[model samples]
Target: MTMMDALGLIENRSYLSSIVAADTALKAANVTLIDLEIIRGGYVTVKLIGDVGAVKAAVEAAKDAAESFGALISAHVIPRMHEETAKLIEKQKGRPAASPEGAKPTAKQEKEETGEQAKTEAVQEESPSPAATERNEENGQEKLTREQLEKLTVVKLRQLVRERKAMESATQINTAKKAELIHSLLEKMEKKE
Candidate 1:
């Protein structure tokens, strides 16, 4: 085997439950990993290959493995095939997006392409999107996104729950295919307060 073949990834998972969840998640994606190394510090890096779908799933599964184990795991999505930006560009058809209608190609012409692909071309021009923050700021009355709920430093989650004057539903989460996001938010409040 070449030197490239010898390098491997290491990961550590949290608990038995997480391990099961992580393993199941990985297996569903058809990634073949040896030396699952489920110990607190064991890691199994599956070499990256296969179609975009399978590779992406394997990477995600490995990440879930770390999250499940509650391990300080670091998984890097190395662009084994080529430079990352190039790989991303390849995701888009090779030719650059056509310029907007009647727009002349000037120094600003390249910058004017506000379509999705242009934004990906260079990261320097990007601005932080406010959609998520705006969604989180609605009088604290609007439903919280998973991330917003996650960020509330426990105490804040409690205050928000008490402030929730209306109850949405209970049976929605427990006996359903999905967990109650709102209920989880309320739980945060109760746990903190």
Candidate 2:
């Protein structure tokens, strides 16, 4: 069999969880980390290559270990990957890998580190351009986008929740949920206005 005949893939929401999974897989069986893909929304997929049996064992070990750290999106072993699959993997390798979720800089952090030029850049990054704005308007008053909501600090989200008298609901939710709820509330408030 060719070297790329057997493969395993594991996906997780947390980078730390992925690392744990990769580590466990290597220790559990004779496998090597072949590729890693970071998809949007903080999802990461780790690929491993080895003999079919080894790949299966590694994937099982990784699945169990990764689940404990965070959400385990998926885990699977492919005994024989198709030619197209190999080409796709090669294509992905050509592109630079994305930074882990936690390592990414926030708009405020960028602004603080850099000066007015950076502050302007941060705002530009958050704001949709004139063309996008026109398109959004044409679509009949688009609500706050997810990217915009993510840019807001947790404190800002909590404050917005309190303002809308949703403190009771927001109190139990995590920071991400708080940001989403606040964004929804602000949209509703705008509609009312």
Best by lDDT: 2
Instruction: Spell out the clash pairs found in candidate 2.
Output: none
Model 1, stretches more than 4 Å misplaced? 1-10, 13-22, 37-49, 81-193
Candidate 1 matches the true fold with a TM-score of 0.27
- What is the C-alpha lDDT profile of model 2 across 1-193, one tens digit per residue? 2435687999999888998899999999999898777889989999998888999999999999998986799999888766566556654676323323467765754654577677778767755454543223433543454565566656655655565554455545344475567666566556544
lDDT by residue for model 1 (6-116), tens: 112334444453455446545756543333344434443333333445546666666665665576356544333444433333334344433335867655435545654
C-alpha displacement of 119 in model 1, angstroms? 60
* Clash count, one per candidate: 5, 0
Model 2 poorest ten-residue lDDT run = 133-142
Candidate 2 runs further than 4 Å off? 1-4, 95-193
- Model 2 vs. true fold: TM: 0.46
lDDT of 2 at 89: 64
